[model samples]
Target: MNEPDVAVDEALPAPRPMPHGLDPDGLTVGVEEEFLLVNARTRRVASQAPSVLAAAADRLPGLRPELTRFQLEVATATCRTAEELHRQLRTARGTLTAVAREHGLRLAATGSPVLGRVTPPPLTDHPRYEALIGQYGALADALSLCGYHVHVGMPGREYAVQVSNHLRPWLPVLLAISANSPFWDERDTGHASWRYLLWSRWPSAGPPPRFASPAHYDSAVRTLLHTGAALDAGMTYWDIRLSAVHPTIEVRVCDAPATVDEALLLALLTRALVATALAATEPAPAIPQHALRAALWRSARDGLEGMGVDAVEREVLPMRELTQRLVEHARPALEATGDLAVCTELLDAVLRRNSGAARQRRAFCRRQRLTDVVDLLTAQTAGATALT
Candidate 1:
């Protein structure tokens, strides 16, 4: 009889190599979609994240985190190409819907839906969430509002910050493109993108100065940390900025886009923005911060409705004219990604619809009820193209 001893410790598998790309070996597209859970029957915000995730835990393809008890987030897997990213998003959304249905919960993608009153929910017991709420208080909870943050990995932090800075001029344009939030706190705010205005209330919100370099951006972040303007880089919540953790420029300005098509339009524009900005080797334009802030307000107030933004000329113009000029400016980038058709289709869609904000407003107006808004928002779950 021979007794062979088995080792107590097993050999761990080697880490997989990151994907190769022109941007970086690790360069890829990632998305963070914050969603609000609603009662399928009542259409009110549901505190069912834990229950739903528990039931669907086996199916989620990528990281799924609950921001609040009622809010769930699903991230797209890192992919070298947009097509792959789209696939990942589709898979994730499908999984969420399947899981939510298991728990009789409906998930909705919206910056702010009109039917519910949002007060800070107890921070989920997770340490990061608890600490985040502890440090930031109700602000973290107030962000119960949903948003989709698209991150495009860059070659270096320096390049990312440069892109971030270069992006400041176009930040409002980005915001305008995805301005889908029309209601706040169960009431019509008479604005297309009330979420944008709501988000800017935080101390560290909005576009920051164009950094001289990554080092310069770091210095400013460090200074803010020391002075207590922000507890950490994450709290800055800039419309666009270099992520302290990920080597990517995080475009935080866009509202919750209605569908995958809308998300990709914004994503391509984001990547093209970085490409165009890098190619120009230009310093951040010398635009007034106040003017930028005001422009954002105008976009939110009248997403392609009121006068258009004239950043350089500093005058009001037609929204359609501004939209066309913005498209033309982004033409080269669109062509490079082969997303020109998609972008045009989506752009025309945005122009025709009243923005997500406008659509929400109209939906609420027709029904003349907040509860109806909830039903409409619930249909926005999964993907915009998906038949509810």
Candidate 2:
């Protein structure tokens, strides 16, 4: 049953004691990818999630969660190194692709397929999602709102929070680089990532300020609960924030990356970014929110082709230039982890031509029909298609 649109709130899951200090050597990376369900025959979305889940239970390992009947979330095992991260992502994709094929379905990677509508069957009966529907009601089940979540294990809660504080200012740059959602409900939304707008609506979403300390961060979360500002500490979906459960800071700005390389580039960059911030003597100075948001808008509207305003120096920088600047800026930190080469090689490709969304648009224009676009999107998500 759907909760009324009227005001009603429910208590959140209980908070537990925080974890220990950050571990520099104990590197672990985890990824949770969300996808929309689509019919194999039509390529249009079908709420065929429950049937697919049941049929493919043996295929999926322990980490898959059904967000809705048509929506699925698959997580990678905690990777101890970059190679492990790559392997886990491939395994998750392979298993999910095989299962989807068995059920005559395809998983889509785009944040919101141009043709998606929020209507879809609710597959899971879990209280967590039920509580979600009951609380937010219709607003919670937006089917097109797809995303990719990457968790970088932090040294500890305090360092995670500290990194999160510094990371918030740069979250928009990540979003700009990763903008891949160009259409909604099968029509052009005129924004590279309409999904970003949807995500920003949630109370806990968007960039957060620098927390004073890990202890201060915890106290603030507690205060949010006591004041009714948040349903729980988990709701603190700050664009960049320390995970209350995991010993990591979670970055939530990116739309689900279309290509595997895009995903890996983001993952590597995030690790380098965090290390850079943590080692710095003073907090990274904040970027002007207005300028950052405007750059984000340009990035979403035009992807890498759009020029962004430099909030720091107050000038216009070409998207390609900004991207280069980011790589150069993070060279020292990436070098620390020896992932600088990975980042440089990936950026070379992204800067040259078009992004995933751009290529998808080109394909759609080639066939001049929505069906063709669906075929393209389905292939990318299913891993049967390739741009590599």
Candidate 3:
């Protein structure tokens, strides 16, 4: 059944103000995690988000509808510490798990659906969404992808744009760590993140251009709007961009990870990256756009298990080496935020078990059934099982 667009309640908590005299090192961070609603029995995408969200509204007031009825999203209140974000993510995911279960559905954090239906999934009943479908046609029709976004507070929009330049080279490394969509349409797509390929169909959805200044960024967005490549500023779907509604830089590069801890790891790493970028005295390297694109493709194809392109060096290297370099790049910031130890532990765990995509493929190989992969994702989302 098609679901009506559900409005988010104002009762949701606002971004928390930084405590008095808190070290600016502790930049506020928030995350928005998108999830797919799956039928518990059939293990297929279920267009029941409106009812699931309605049932969860009073208890889990932060829940909101997404572009498609088969998906739901929740944003964390602004947080200063990883511990605080961890608690909030756990509470939200737990509540959503119970709510979805009661409504005969399961919340799966995988990037794309593992099963297929005869018809396209229904879009939420919103006029803007209808217009998007009218404008983009098939590109908008294949919009059932879920992503994990991290928003780090910035002093100003111009500074945020500058920081994004520093962030460009590391984007592929981050995507490799969080690549979670290996299966789609009941088959292994052989790519760690099929969602990335699917999402790239949008003309405005890949890596953002390196802007010389805030004016350059604005002019580029204006071009997208004038050319009808994007319906609005919100549609400037760069991998990272200044948030339209928040005083933060938003990184929208990863698939929705399978576990809350994975989400926390991404959030902490992103905050550290932003903080590191802000403190740097030297200019960021001007890596060629073609090199960066090649790096992104490698990250999406091989995830953490294979070679990755070093955009800075213009050479291919082991993903493990690139992953370590990313951690080292943000080491000072991680230490300042007291998250270095935790980040190290999480990185070790992910490497030991493999990326989410690798784990999902392993599950399918064990039983040769897509349903087993769905079960794994459902369990991981609910924190019912270790992401082993």
Candidate 4:
């Protein structure tokens, strides 16, 4: 994408006032998880989102359409506690699974299609989506990606922007843990999270710049908009960003995890990370852009089973070490929120399995059939069984 020569002083809305006496540990958190609707018999993505969504119309506001007709998204209501968030996610997943079954489909929470042909799925019926296809042809066609997005409440946009800086170094680690897209189009992609690589094709996607201030963030966004790299703030697609429609810092680093327990782990750790950032007295780490990108690639390529780069130190280390560092860094906040024990248990479970990617690979290796992978995803998505 070409960078447009635009004035940096574009008028933008003033930042809102920071809330007084805000408690970081008590901040509300929510998640929006995307899933692929799969044909139960064929084990292929089914473009029945329109009919399925209509069947689930009563679950509106919580359940919504995605960029592709094969994709559906479910969002949790703002939750004050980790357990409450877990309940919401479980209920949402269960309800959606039932609704999809009613339409002769199954909800697969894997990040990408496991057993389908690599054909362009139908675009959702919306003018904005049509415009996207018109603007970015092939990129729009390969939009069958699913993600687990976490929103951590912030005091204001300015604060959220600052929190994003603190988030950059840890983003890769989170991606590694939630890496679930091992197979695509009936073949292993070799990369754990193929979704991340596919998503990076977007002009405005991936790690965001480290802004010095809220104005700097706005200036950078204005440049993307002016250059048409991004259609609007909502399209910025940064791994971390100030939510365009909510008073929260949204983290988009993770692919949709295989199970609700995995999703809860991401949410709890993310909230704790945000709380840690809020309490920090030191400035955000000054990791270089190249180092950050390298770290992300390493995470996506290896998931939690290989070496990872410590962006801050610019040194490669075992991914397990990086994950430990992440938990340690966020320990105080985790304890403050009374989620440390549950987070520890979830983290232990994930590590034992290696990652969602590893679990999928294990399933595939068992029968050497992608249908097994699809079955695993379908079963897990419906809360019928776990990867173990």
lDDT, model 2: 0.68
For candidate 4, lDDT tens digit of each residue in 25-52? 8989999999999998898889999998
lDDT, candidate 3, residue 75? 91
The per-prediction CA RMSD against the true structure, in angstroms, equals 11.5, 7.0, 8.3, 3.9
Against the hidden reference, what TM-scores do the models get?
Answer: 0.87, 0.86, 0.93, 0.94
Candidate 2 TM-score, C-alpha based:
0.86
Which residue runs of candidate 3 sit more than 4 Å off their true CA positions? 1-24
Sorted on TM-score, highest at the top, how do the candidates line up?
Answer: 4, 3, 1, 2
Count of clashes, each model: 2, 8, 0, 0
lDDT of each: 0.70, 0.68, 0.87, 0.87
Model 4 misplaced regions, further than 4 Å = 1-20
Q: Which candidate, 2 or 3, would have the higher lDDT against the true structure?
A: 3
Error of 1 at 64 (Å): 2.8
Per residue, candidate 3 scores C-alpha lDDT tens digits across 40-128 of 99998899999998999998756899999999999999999899999999999999999999999999998988875613659999999
Better of 1 and 3 by TM-score: 3
Per-residue lDDT tens digits of candidate 1, residues 21-130? 45331246688887778887777788778887677667775546565777778777776666787787778777787778778777777887555657766446687677
